[model samples]
Target: MDTTDDARTRIDTTVAHPARRYNYWLGGKDHFAADRASGDAIAAAMPGVKLMAVENRAFMGRAVRYLAEQGIRQFLDIGTGIPAPNNTHEIAQSVDPSSRVVYVDNDPIVLTHARALLTSAPGGANAYIDGDLRDPEAILAHPDLPATLDLSRPVALLLVAVLHFIREDEHPERIIETLTAALAPGSYLVASHATWEYLPAEVIAALTRNNTDGRFQARTAARFAELLAPFDLVEPGIESVAYWHADDVPGPRPSAEEVACFGAVARIR
Candidate 1:
């Protein structure tokens, strides 16, 4: 973890951040007034948005456990928001203590909480890289990445609840291609993306504004699946987050409408 004063300075408390807002929605107290205002606005516009956040995270836990069941031990988790329960490494290492993971995120506040996310089991290696998804090459070439993961082995790339922040012009598919091309055939890609399928156009428009920086573009289910076209989709492909792997889900399940995110896991073949 960098934890440098300069890096911490980049966080703008005045403006709402998706990561912090997400934390706020998850009932965490790490957010400021701006984040609360923004989160409350979005939740008010579309009811149960906080449920979406919870379901999206549950999707991550299911997907990570699925990868571990498939015997994949290396993970490169990007867009990792503020540290939360059932983190990628925690889920993966629980299945196999030797599982190795490297988390990447450009959010300075997330990096500040990196220490909590970096714990590993006796036989595992866990590290964090302060990087962004827009730059696949930089994430691929991160020095700590190779040290934590073996490129030759099957690794699961986790991209949960993050791609919606990347606009279409940014070439999100190409970013996936670049990252996937660097992995071996059996490597897996697990992703969950926000969608406008169930929402009316009016609600979509309102959410668009509440989101900071005019970002947060929700895609259709087919368009979301297109992001993983290069790989072979696993069972229950591209379903709503809450239903992706329902049996693996813990506690009472959130309804489909409560989760507007499309979730899937695929293998490079």
Candidate 2:
């Protein structure tokens, strides 16, 4: 089928998708009733779920800006959800208008809105590919990716708030390894993952029960680090998204338990 027909066929409003549910959590208007129901069910179990989503977004912005400032001009943002403010390309191009970004996601809704993610600055470029995180090879093989980003040069791989959705059986470590192996030595890996380490036993149990679809799998800080492999972490490693270079994010940041996510930036060794 053609891209348009494929997208239309894949979009089922009756089923809850991670991208739409995440858009609902972020207060975007693109989600359907099913997405809202799933989001609400999770929020019912963990009252701070929305807060975690918001903080995770902020962490992504901070990481992109940091990488851009470090002279990185290319970004590979996997699991790109519905278009939102301060997206990876926006943040990166803001620093250097020539920045190039290629976003990959399997969501058909995201595919329909690919144009919004493609708006680049005058000198920069952006591209969107309908792809899944489980298959890193296909993402790297997409024509748009190579056309938009030179893999021989440094590139920042942004896997923000999407890793937890990749179940243990999916072999997330292998996925990361495959992606990182395709990057240059100076390239970086910026990631944030949901963690269960800080939650109370009751909250954890409730979250587990509410996760009927098995969409989430929160990991500990140590396990999250292990997934990154040989990459050397940057300073302030494995911090809560609320405090990851949040110097300008105002006073009284939320605790790690409330955020329930860990973010880190690491270099390709």
lDDT (0 to 1) per candidate: 0.88, 0.92
| lDDT (Cα, tens digit) per residue for candidate 2, span 5-113 | 6797889999999899999999999999999998998898888989999999999999999999999999999998999999999999888999999999999999888
At residue 92, candidate 2 shows an lDDT of 93
Per-candidate TM-scores read 0.95, 0.97
Candidate 1 segments exceeding 4 Å error = 248-252
How many residue pairs clash in each candidate at the backbone level? 0, 0
What lDDT score goes with residue 204 in model 1?
A: 80
Q: Residue-wise lDDT of candidate 1 within 47-81, one digit each (tens)? A: 87888998899889988988899899999999998
- CA lDDT for candidate 1: 0.88
Q: What is the lDDT of residue 46 in candidate 1?
A: 86
The prediction achieving the highest lDDT against the true structure is 2
